[model samples]
Target: MMHVLYWSGRAGSLAPLCLLIECGVPHETVQVDTSRHAHKTADYLRDVHPLGTVPALRLPDGQVILESGAMVLHLAELAPSLAPAAGSADRAMFLNWVAYGAGSLYPAYQRVYHTDHIVPDEAARPAAREAAVVALDRCWDVVEAALEAGRPGLFGDRPGAADVYLAMLALWHPAPERLAAACPKVRAMKDAVWALPSMRQALAVHGLETA
Candidate 1:
């Protein structure tokens, strides 16, 4: 059984949780309360991860893994149902979807969200906000086009790790009201993504899903 040690929030590890669900593999999700500095505690780190990050997965043999992207890639390889066939069209699509999230979408979201976390000082927030908006707009456009392309799923006809990653990333973005209105494609893409059960669960965990 795979054991995923994670925080309740979606944060960076949200994709892994969704992938675990998609895999339908026997596993357990341990909610690590970050507010209490649980993730930063030495005991938690020593037991599961050297770095103070949640989503440190423990394999049955006792190897621990970190970083959501690498973790999901590994999980995909383990659970073929959630990945794609080697050298097939599905595989190419799957890999592209995965790359877009971690390479493009995720970095863009971080560029925006990091402004809040990294620039806590009130004085520096304005310039940071400008750069964030520019980055966010560009990211949204990229996703917007992909969804408009009419792919049945991120990897064609089925959801995979990449689709999960994109959905989780969208939750962090929140599809800003005006932005969504201006870009129907973005909202459509988000709607299509959140329509899945696994994505919904991740959103609920992240406090992004509404009634």
Candidate 2:
């Protein structure tokens, strides 16, 4: 069984929770309420995730994994059904897309939604947010093109951990209208991923109906 440190309604927490359900892994959820800034406390930063991020997973062997994408990759290795085999033909693309979503696109959404954290100056937030919107839309376009080329799923005929990561980011990004207009394929992909029973259950836990 894995143990996940989570906070409700946070996008980062969604990946680990959904992966656990998809893998049929028995897990315990330790809620770190961000509403009260519990995640920012020194105890949390030191004892849990050093960067104070939620969705850190404690493995059965006393190893704690940070980064939602890293957790998904590890879980995929454990449960091969969740992703392609490491050396498989599709594995390289899968890995690339996962890293792109986490390292590139996800931060763009962060800049849009958490502008205050990105720039302390209130006056500068507008420009930052506008720039993020452009970057985010471009990111969506890239993913959409990739999905269109790889149809049925992100990598081939079936969804993988990378698609799950994409879905999470697509849902969290602030410009849904822009996303729909710019990345119809990705929007459709997200719909398919969310329709899965595992993802449905995960979203329901946070009272989310759709994304």
Best by lDDT: 2
For this target, which candidate reaches the highest TM-score against the unseen true structure? 2
Question: Per-residue CA lDDT of candidate 2, range 98-188, in tens?
Answer: 8998888877878888889979899988998899888888878888777774365676566677888888888876768777777878877
Expressed as tens digits, the lDDT of each residue in 42-139 for candidate 1 is: 89888876888776777767788776777778779878877778889868877777777778876777667677777878788879877887777777
lDDT (0 to 1) per candidate: 0.70, 0.79
Global lDDT of model 2: 0.79
**Which stretches of candidate 2 lie above 4 Å from their native place?**
none
